[model samples]
Target: MNNGAVIFAANVDRVARFYEVILTMSPVYVEPGLRVIASDRTELVIHGVPPQVLAPAASGAAPEPREDTAIKPFFVVGSLAKARDMAPLLGGFVFPPEREFTSRRFRACNACDPEGNVVQFRELLVSAI
Candidate 1:
């Protein structure tokens, strides 16, 4: 089955640039409030969300943002180090990469776009023969 994910961004263009650099792929589609970037047949859609929709109510009667409601998209990268280095340059923050027992050949890192959406990147380790 084909896999895809959508991320809401305050600035669609900015987030699109960030993913373009990390994925090494230009956006295949772009519009006023939307951008779609694809790599290896998988698509990542960045949608611009209006400030009013994301802002607290004028009456100060809004619930705080919840971690459980966040959308985290995981990406497989050719080089974690390169992606990590490029993240900050494109207005994104890259956490240090770590190897997990569940991911034998992958070193993963969590990164956030300027809009504060978490995106995970994983690098496949070369096998020693």
Candidate 2:
């Protein structure tokens, strides 16, 4: 089975764009209110926030980060160094290299998308040997 996540955003395009720039994935589908980006093992569905769910302050220009939530999706990337540099330009933030930690097979960091949805990012540390 292909593992995936569905993220809701005030601006679906912007959120989807952030993931596109950071992960090694391209959009499989796109529309004003929804987007689907996929890789070999992961897929992300970016959907527009429903009006009932949108906060009055959650404007499309700058969204409040929903940091207090419990769920945080993780993505495997090609390089944390590259993500760090690029995230800011795209209205997102990736934790600094100092915050990184290494697992048996990957180096990982925390990150947040343009709408302030918290997530984690990891890159391969070594191949199985």
Which candidate leads the pack in lDDT?
Answer: 2
Question: How many residue pairs clash per model?
Answer: 0, 0
- TM-score (C-alpha) between model 2 and the true structure: 0.84
- TM-score each candidate: 0.78, 0.84
Q: Rate the local accuracy (lDDT) of all candidates.
A: 0.71, 0.83
Query: Tens digit of lDDT per residue, candidate 1, span 82-110?
Result: 98788777777676655322368777877
RMSD of 1: 5.9
Off by over 4 Å in 2: 55-65, 127-129
Best TM-score among the predictions, by candidate number: 2
